[model samples]
Every structure is written in structure tokens, then in C-alpha cells.
Target: MGLIVQKYGGTSVGTVERIMRVADRIIEYKNAGNDMVVVVSAMGKSTDVLIEMARQIAPNPSAREMDMLLTTGEQVSIALLAMALQQKGYDAVSLTGWQAGIATESVHGKARIQEVDTARIRSELQRGRIVIVAGFQGISEKGEITTLGRGGSDTTAVALAGSLRADKCEIFTDVSGVYTADPRVVPMAQKLDSISYDEMLELAILGAGVLHPRSVEAAKKYKVKLVVRSSFSQEEGTCVEEAADMETGRVVSGVAHDEDIAKITVVGMPARVGTLSRLFNTLAGAQINVDIIIQSSYDAAVTNISFTVSSDDLVRTLDTLAAYQEALGFDKVEHESGLAKVSIVGAGMITNPGVAAEMFQQLAEQDISIKMVSTSDIKVSCVIPAEQTSLAVRTLHTAFGLDVAEQAVVHGI
Candidate 1:
């Protein structure tokens, strides 16, 4: 029998009926003679509700205490799903992160997994029990409760699969599979049958939201195969592996977009080499993330730098730059909010000539200006006005021939 690791998202376990549906999905795998270990997230909106409740009590709650409170959501999901499986006449047991031996870094809100002690899970499987794990939360070596940041459950599931040396990891969610673009934004977005690890990593980082970037990173590092499909359907789904089928001959695989981006520009700085390094170091000290940096030079020794950060980090980023302004030796800082980043990603584009040119030409035709640009061998991203994200995504989806004849369902729409 092959050993398998699977994870279901919040929407898949949101209600009793939905939980029952997921249990049925699990039973099919079990009956196929596979040893099963399932991971699950909190019920739909429950984590959000808990966060709002905590913020209601205090605008800024302690991260450690928040981890203690937020983990209860997944606890609820695991117990209920375990009960559901048992009621369906299957032997099942639920184990929280600590009980299952998932050890992570001491960081509370966004801890990274350090190791997995698989003795307990292996024992349970040998006893003919389906093991259920609480995803997204784990215990640190110092005995602190910690959570993987948003979509960390994907990380948890994949981590388990790698540690246990399972055959493959299956990530079931509300959406059927990874798409060329978010179906909600672009109705004609087509689902991809398969994608390479590098392409998925870019999508996840660029706000695909279908899979977590950390999980993709782990999959590549460990060489574990991943399948993303909807828990609610029997679609073929998308397979993520080291090398994907390249027979499609499509230069650009998909267009991904992220709204709620803000830009910070530091004006009039010496073109000295370490100036840029020290300036970014200031933000790094504050744990602020930077993306898409562009530098403009007026003359040989004077330059201006513009960089993008998620809007959620705008205040922190601006304050960080201002505090170091005098030390960093910049004339002034300028800021812009409500910007969006739309990117086209594909491994096939590596050998395709003029792929970025095609993207620019299409955007130019629609009069959508590109503010900041970032590129890799397989991806090109343009930051445009937030209000124009939908237009930009759809325009590029068709431009790259990623559209299907039918509309796609937008979960949570």
C-alpha cells in the first residue's frame, strides 16, 4: 500500500455537511489500500472571527497569546473531522500539532517547521487508523505554540509528506485547480493540468493564493510531488513537479495579480554602492518586505530608488525609511498607495523570444501604464493602478491565449 499525505482547506471543512463530504473523499483513498494521513485548516471564517474578537478586546494583541487563541480553530476542525470519519465506520484519530510531533521555530505568528517526529503517526497507521493532523500550527522546541503564516497548512501537509517519505501530497481546496489567472478576476481563465515547481513558486509568491510559497519551496527541496484539486469535485486537477509537460507550446503559462500594493521612493541619493544596501538593511531590521525595486540615475553620482511593498506594510515601511532618512542621506521620500501587480509566468517562455515585449505591447494597447517592473527568466510583473487590476488580468489572459470558452467559478464571490 502506498502512503499518502493530504490536506483540506477551511472551506472544505466549514460545516458539518462539508466535513462529512471531506470524510467521504478520505474513505475513497483509504479503501484504495493507501495509508492515509490528512491535514486540515480551521472552519470557514472562524479564524477571521477569532482575530476580530481578539482585536475587539485590544487593537494590538500579543502575538504569543494570539497563537494560543487562533490554534483553537484548527483544533475544532480536526476533532470534528475525526468524529465524522469514525461515524462513517472508519478508524480514525485526531492529533494536534504538538501531539503529532511537528516542531517549529519559536516565532509565534509565522513559525517555520524544523523537524517532524514521525514515530507517533507511523504507529497509528500500523494500528489501522487514519491519522488526522491539525495543520497551520505547531510547537517550538521551547514548548511555545506557533502558527505558520497564512496558508501554512499547505506547508504542514507537504512537510509531513516529505518527512514520512509518502508517495505524494494532495492539497484539496475550494477551487478545482491552479488557473491561468484568478477566475474571479478573469472569467475565461483556464485551469492548468500541470505546472513546474518554479512556475508554481512564482505564482504563489505573486499572490496566486492557491498554494503557499513555503510549501512549494519545501516540495522542490525534497522532490515531493503535489496535486492541487477541489475537495468538492473529481477534476483531474494540476500536478506540480520538477519538470512539467512542455508540449502545449504556450510561451506564457499564466497571468497572476496582487492588489493592495504600495510604493515608496527615496529621492536624491549619492550613487555610492553601499547606500542602497544600508537603506534596505534599515527596512530589513523592521521585518519589512521589499519587492520590485527600480533605480533612476540623473547623473553619474546621484540616483533615486523606488520599491514596492504590500499595502499592509506601508505604514511600517514609510516609518522605517523616515527614521533612517538622515543616516541614509536621502533628500526626500515619496509614497503611493492602491497600486496592483499583475504578472505573467511560464517556464516555456525561457526559449520564447519577445514574450515580455508581447505583454508590454498588449498593455500599451489598453493604455494601462506600468509603474514598476520585475522580471525573472520565467516571469514578468507590472504594477498598475489598483482599479485596473481586473482589466489588466483579463486583457493579458486573452493576449496569451489562456482563455477557455466557459466562465470559471469564483470561490467566496
Candidate 2:
């Protein structure tokens, strides 16, 4: 029998009835003659509710304690799911990330997986038992519970699949699969049957929100076949595999938009070598992530450098840069919040030219002014006013022919 690893998001196992429903699906897979390993995230809104509770008690909670408190959400789901499976007459055991052998670095809030020792999981699978493991939480070498940042559950599932060499890794979530655009905003957005890992990574970064980029990287590195399906439906979901397996070469696969970005422009800096380095080094020291960097060298004497960072870090990033103002000798640092980043992703965009021009033209027709633009081989991103995000997404979705006539209803777990 083949080994299959499945991951259920918060919504899938949110309630007692939902947990039982998941158990039935797991049993169906087991009855099909496949050994199963399931990964579960925190129940719906449990983590957020816990975080709110923590905030009520303490304005600034310690990261260690916060992780300890937040991880309980997934623990609760694993136990409930295990109980549901056992009630159905199928043998099941729940294990925490640490118990399942997921080892990570010592970073408290945003730890990275160092390695996974699958001895316990392997032994349990060999015993003809369905193993349930908590996702998003892992143990550090110091024996502390650490989380893998946002979307850690996806990373955990992919990592487990890689370490176990499972036949497939199935990600069950609220959405059926990856779509050409968000269906809520673009009613005609078509579901992609297959996508390459690179395109998926770009889409994830651009706010497609189906799969985490880290998970995609892990799957690509380990060559694990990943499927995204709806927990509420039985229909076949999208498969993310290597590019060679895909037949179609559409220039645009999807449109993704993020409205949580702020642009910071360090204007009128000396154009001398290492000037920009000094400015960015300060931001790096403060642990801020900068995206979409653009530098214009007007003359040999001065340059205008601009970049984007999360809105949450706008103040901190500005303060950090301000601290180095004297050393870098810049004119001033200005920031614009309430900005959004909209991106178009496709695997075929690398070979196809004029895709960016068309994207810009469409946005212009809608009177959406683009503040900045960035392009990679497979993706194009533009920064615009946050208010124009929905309009821009709908426009781009229609421009790319993503609107479908009939909406596909998803089925099965």
C-alpha cells in the first residue's frame, strides 16, 4: 500500500461534526488500501481567539509563552480528530509536532524546520494505525515549542511528506483549489487543474493564499506531488507538479493582490558606491523585509531609492533608516501607506513577451495609477492605491480571460 500524507486546515476540522466528517474521509482512504498520515492545523479562529486572550492579559506577551499558548489550538484538533477516527473503528493516534519528530531551529515565533526524524511516525505507520500530527508547532533543540510563522501548517505537511517520501501530500482547505483569480472578486475565475511549483510560489507571495511558498519550496526540493482540494467537497483538486508535466502554455495563470504594503522612498541619496548598502543594512539590522526595490540614478552625485515593506513595519523601518540618515547623507525618507501590490503570475510569461505591457494598459484603462512595478521571469507585480485593488483585480481577471461561464462545485475531502 502507498503512503499518503494529508493536511487539514483550521476550517476543515473546526467543529465536532466537521472532525467526524474528516474521520470518514480518512477511513475512505484507508479502506482504499493506502496507509495514512494526517496533519491538522488549529481549529477555526482558535489561534486568533487565543491571541486575543493573551493580549487582554498582557499587552506584550513573551514570544515563548505566546507560542506555548497558540500551539494548543492544533493540539486540540489532533486529539479530537483522533477520537473521532477511533469511534469509527479505525485505529488512530494523535501526536504533537515534537512527538512526530519535527525538529526546528530555536527561533521562538518564526522557527524553521531543521530536520525531521521520522522513526516514531514510521513505526506507527507500520503498525497499521492512522497517525495524526499537529501542524505549525515544532520543538526546538532546547525543548521549547516553536511555531513556523504564518502558514506553518502547510510547511509542516510538505516537510513530513518529504521526509516520509509519501506518494502524495494532500492539502485540504476551505477553497477547492488554485484559481486563475479570487472567485469572490472575479466570478469567472477558472480553477487551474495543474500548476508548476515556481508559479505557485509567485502566486502565494502575491496573495493567492492557497498554498504557502515555503511548502512549495519543500515540495519542489523533495519532488513531492502536492494536491490542493476542498475538505467540504469530493471533486478532484488542483495538482502542483513539475513544469514538464503541464501541456498548456498560457501566458497568465492568475491575478493576486496584497493590500498590506507601504512604500518607503529614500530620496536624494549620494550615488556613490555603498550608499544604498548603508541604508538597507540599517533596515536589515532591524529585521524588516523590504520588497520591490527601485533605484534611479539621476546623476553621478545622487540617486533616488524606493522600496516596499509590510505596513506593520513601516514605522520601525523608517526609524531604522532615520537613525542612519547622517551616515548615509540622504535628503529625506518618505513613506506612503494604504498601498496595494497586485501581481500576475504564469509559467509561460518567461517565453511570452508584452505581458507586462498589456497588464499596465489594462490598469491604465481603469484609471488605476501604478506607483511601482517589479517583474521576475514568471510574475509581474504593480503597486497601486489600496482603494483600487478590487477594481484592478476584477479588471485583470477579465483581461486574462479567467472568468468562467459556469462555476465548478467542488466535492469530497
Candidate whose lDDT is highest: 1
Candidate 2 achieves a global lDDT of 0.91
**Per-residue lDDT of 199 in model 2:** 88
Structural similarity to truth (TM-score) of each candidate: 0.94, 0.94
lDDT of 2 by residue, 114-194 (tens): 999999999998899999999998999999999997789999999999999999999999878998887766767788899
Off by over 4 Å in 2: 268-270, 322-331, 408-413
Q: Lowest-lDDT window of 10 residues in candidate 2?
A: 404-413
Best by the TM-score measure: 1
lDDT of 1 by residue, 126-187 (tens): 99999999999999989999999889999999999999999989999988899999887788
Minimal lDDT window, size 10, model 1: 241-250
